[model samples]
Target: MSASQALGGPSRCGWVLGPSLDKIIKNVAWRKHSQLVAACKSALDKLDSVVDDPVDPASCTPLYGLSTSDTDFVLQPLIMALDSASPKVVEPALDCSFRLFSLGLIRCEIDTPTPTPSPSPSPNPSSHSHIFRLIDSVCKCGALGDEAIELAVLRVLLSAIRSPYVLVRGDCLVHIVRSCYNVYLGGMNGTNQICAKSVLAQMMIIVFTRVEENSMMVDFKTVSVAELLEFTDRNLNEGSSIQIAQNFLNEIVDVKSKEGIAESKLCLQLEYDNSEKKGEPIDGEPGEGADLSGYSKIREDGFMLFKNLCKLSMKFSSQEHGDDNILLRGKVLSLELLKVIMDNAGPIWRSNERSSVVKSVDTSVNLDNKEDAASDDLCISKPRRSTRIVIPPKRLDSYLWAGRKSREQGKS
Candidate 1:
């Protein structure tokens, strides 16, 4: 009558109601019996009905139509197979979970509760535990050179990052960062390389915007930027390190403080409004300027973060041309940090400009210097495989003709 009996029993509901199946697997000494493994493999194939068509073309999940008991029956076996030692069982298990997660059948949980002693345990497994197990399976597959599995897992992780739950987003971010770090350390293979690039690009966009705007809401304290830099430094040689540091610095310069402040206000307002909609406090008094205080604090912290990053980069960038006494050398002791402050502290910088506190120089004099700096910046910023201008070689006759014309004109 239970889910497990349905799986091993001769009934249509066996595959549909199978959480009780875990009890049978637990009861049997399957670890010691070769026949039990074969039976599990066969049972898994049948229970994995949603592996191929979890969601229809319109992104509708047919699983929602199923009764709650039926959903539990289907998900339980897949969750169990995720931990199966056999790759055959694990593959379909992963496929089923990925499909269900992608189809929105299982919502990502914010908190994963630890199992404790209880009089009665529920047959249903926690979605949180399922997700963690799925991620574990993904890492194992990647280690075993299962490129396809890695890509599937990445898609699921990306979906989880968009969850409204902050904890879910943080967990997803950790998974992505770990994936990227692994790719960096192990050297990304073909399919996994593509998967990593796709994931990293999405992650960078999310992190950059989220950190720039709702710095308070999105928790990134768990992910250490310094640790990321160190990991990247280990994988990168001196030349590459200099280039990455230079490129990041150039990107920083291109970020405009005025636009950033405006964007921050918009994002903060949205966050406050959303919180209120969800019946949560706005963190401060609800008014036009409620978020202003938070925004200012975030701005200050952002400036400090950038200042620290630039200082850290200086240590790395020095390796490129230590003897040349680079740009940081002999400069106003605190000028670099000052520039960062000015760039981010729009009010102070704008006030100084208005009061003529900062001197202006002729544009033409700095034109050559600007061009050189632009070129250097481009070396780091632009894609290496960019379109280039190709000039044709001038023929000797063209030069001679021009010389003869000049002589004739002068004589005339």
Candidate 2:
């Protein structure tokens, strides 16, 4: 008989060692720094062996047979270790967690059978919970340290987001938004903020692509555009959200151009130039062609986000006191964001009647303010050049104030 059979089957084997593993994991929290690091390294080494096993299927891996509760028990301590002050403990903890996450994904695959002509298969509940807990842990790790840890956290996140299991991907999406919002509002600086924004940008691309292809596993209702906008709005004071929004809009613009703006505008346009063309309406069920409804919804939501940011910018500008350099910086960032948004979403802007009318009004105003050569020569431009030179010092002051604010916020 095989070793598994001799041990009274995989389930029995799991039951036998579960308690021992449980005890070891529990003691991890109480161990001294050195002992804790050693334990994490030991656990990681063992897990690495199983994870790297080429001969055994996932079901035959060491972690596959543990019950859900036992699995969680084993995972909880390692996850907590990710927050350890020592990099030695956190690194091994991160590795161990990632290996466990991989095994969980494998277990999920084995539990869920291939689809036939029947109804769609649901994800395994135990595996779903396991994966979600791990995802949350990894998300928390994003704020732990500098470049190395952030890169590691990002690697874990990318794996989860790109997971073949739809449920895992969906859970990943939710946690990413939560993590981004937390990191942004928590006023994390330097690498932490960069990591959060990078992850957010990556998630936006994946979500947008999924929606475009009608392959998104979760409903937009679950992770609504409104919630995403709030996440962006909350970080406006720091200007990171503006950068995030700018990157997303840039991607949307590129995608629209590559996919052909005419196709996307089909649903947006009130009247089509080709009246002779007859087919299903753009809103109707797509036969052989791709659906345009998704594109339309994306455009609507993108514009909504853009509009809200603009309003927030105005609100911040109006509320700014001379001493509040933070608000002043926010306004500058918002202006930069507006410039980028207009450039990137030009197609959408041009399609809007109000924008076109505003553009015309601005052109007329500029023309009305035009100066003659004699008058322009009489007005020295030195003051304008001097004002431009003064901006850098003001920007430096705002940045210093922002850093102080972040530190105070953290202290609070």
Candidate with maximal TM-score: 2
In angstroms, the error of model 2 at 309 is 9.7
Instruction: In angstroms, give how far residue 405 of model 2 lies from its true place.
Output: 37
Per-residue lDDT tens digits of candidate 2, residues 164-231?
22223322454555555445334345444444444444444444444333332322211222233332
Model 2 regions lying over 4 Å from their true place = 1-70, 83-86, 96-127, 143-147, 166-175, 181-195, 216-412
Which tens-of-lDDT digit does each residue in 88-142 have in candidate 1? 5455555544444443344333223345843542223444454555555554454
Clash count, one per candidate: 3, 0
Worst 10 residues of 2 by lDDT: 377-386
- For model 1, the stretches where C-alpha displacement exceeds 4 angstroms are 1-73, 110-127, 162-167, 206-412
Q: What is the lDDT of residue 247 in candidate 1?
A: 41
Please state the error at residue 397 of candidate 1 in Å: 44
Per-residue error for 214 in candidate 2, Å, reads 2.3
